[model samples]
Target: MTETARDIVMGRIRAALAAAPPERVEVPRDYDRQPLQGPADVARFAETVADYQARVLRIGADEIAGTIAALLPVGATVAVPGDIPPDWVAGLATVPDDPPLSNAALDATTAVVTGCAVGIAATGTIVLDGGAAQGRRALTLIPDHHICVVFAGQIVDTVPQGFAALNPLRPLTFVSGPSATSDIELERVEGVHGPRTLDVLIVEP
Candidate 1:
């Protein structure tokens, strides 16, 4: 019968593959795996995080709830994961995400509070693995403001170190700073894809 356009394209693709040689390739991975020494450098990390235009506060464990509350506006509605420590957000107007909140509802919320899976001190990146305290990805993305509680113990020196502490199977979100992008003319805009304001509370023992 008739040779259709789809058939012609498939025939050409098959002919091209048959004429190509097959080979196996091996990738080189002899680079330095451990670049940094010891645990995360809190002072360096704070400085790097601040350079990104995000606020960083170092406080004792007892002051966590107060600091978080102070960072948020009065009467603000905060989206929180059910697994987060209750004392961390004590007396705050919080909506739990156990059943998962709708996008519209999350949009209406003023902020979101979460605990990160790991923090990369060298690059000032926060990694979230959709863990119990981190909740789903939508909860952190939809809010205008985000207050993340990061413990010193969870901080790592570099990206490689952070990766070593995380599981590849889980969903990962790495945040370096508040969502921002520059246009062709070099103008910068914030909160385009994520929170405009990121307040990182670095808790020490």
Candidate 2:
């Protein structure tokens, strides 16, 4: 049988790999994991999120529906995840995510309301693990606005602490602020990749 060019190249590559060392690399994890001094603080989380240009609203459980309704514009259409609490969208026009809306449909929607898996206080990051109230990744990415409801109990003091509370295998989306990027000339642009506005409602007990 004649050896083709593709076969010749692959054979050489396989031979090279076979001759390479079988040793595994050990990574160092001595870096600081939880650098924060005190317990997980909601105030610190709110301040850090605001520093990232995302709006924060601290409210009690009773005010959740009303507060969310107030933030959205009149006649706006919102995308609600399948597992999201009904009370959160009591009076709003919400499209369910059970059927998994198309990207174009999601883009046309005014905003998305979701519940976060865990929140990192130190880095001001909200993680969505595609669990429960948090829908698929595209649901959050395609929308122009995102209104996430985070519970005070879900806040962790540091990144390491946050990781310990979640499943490593799940799809995680860490959002620090509104999607933005600066060009070579330093011109800032928002909504280039994800939502331009991120409004977080930190519901306290």
Candidate 3:
């Protein structure tokens, strides 16, 4: 309470602060160099993504509908966003994006396919912004199978690059492969939350 006591306290506080451990920091460069091999980079991205229980597939644009059908069983309802191209749902029971189907209903569906804003090549992250094509967050959460369509042009080289390309104000879901977690013994468990299976269709023009 006294001035001398206050000064001593302040000095002690300063000394404690000075003695504290330094914070670990990561220096983010403007441009992080990607792997020299282009094919290898893509393959590595897919491999790492699959490690999270995500099914990654590279296919031509015209083959999308068929691929979707293959991933989902017959008579299975598929949730398609309002802005999803018609061609994207050629051979499935297309569920409309209105009234926002219940989670229970979504669980009954075979798959939920939506468009992605960006796919990062460096970390194999798929980002959704709740855009017209991506639809609400529930669509992705409730469904067991999530087929995200990522245009080749939308793929970026790195995480920083992807962030710079997107608007932070938007509702964004950054998906780095499928959902998984580890237990006490570091035992891995997949699909406890979010989609258990994430199928990414990289649409190459």
**Which of the numbered candidates is closest to the native, going by highest TM-score?**
1
Residue range 1-205, candidate 2, lDDT tens digits: 4569889999999999899957898999975565445557999999999999999999999999999999989999999898899999998999998899988899999999999999988899999999989999999999999999999988988888888888999999999999999999999999999999999999998
Top of the candidates by lDDT = 2
> For every model in order, what is the number of clashing pairs?
0, 0, 0
Better of 1 and 2 by TM-score: 1
Pairs of colliding residues, candidate 1: none
TM-score, structure 1 vs. true:
0.84
Report the lDDT tens digits of candidate 3 across residue range 156-180: 6777667877899999998987777
RMSD of every candidate to native, in Å, equals 3.9, 4.9, 4.7
Write down the lDDT that model 3 would get.
0.81
Off by over 4 Å in 2: 1-28, 31-39
Residue 7 C-alpha lDDT in model 2? 95
TM-score attained by model 3: 0.80
Candidate 2 vs candidate 3: the lDDT winner is 2
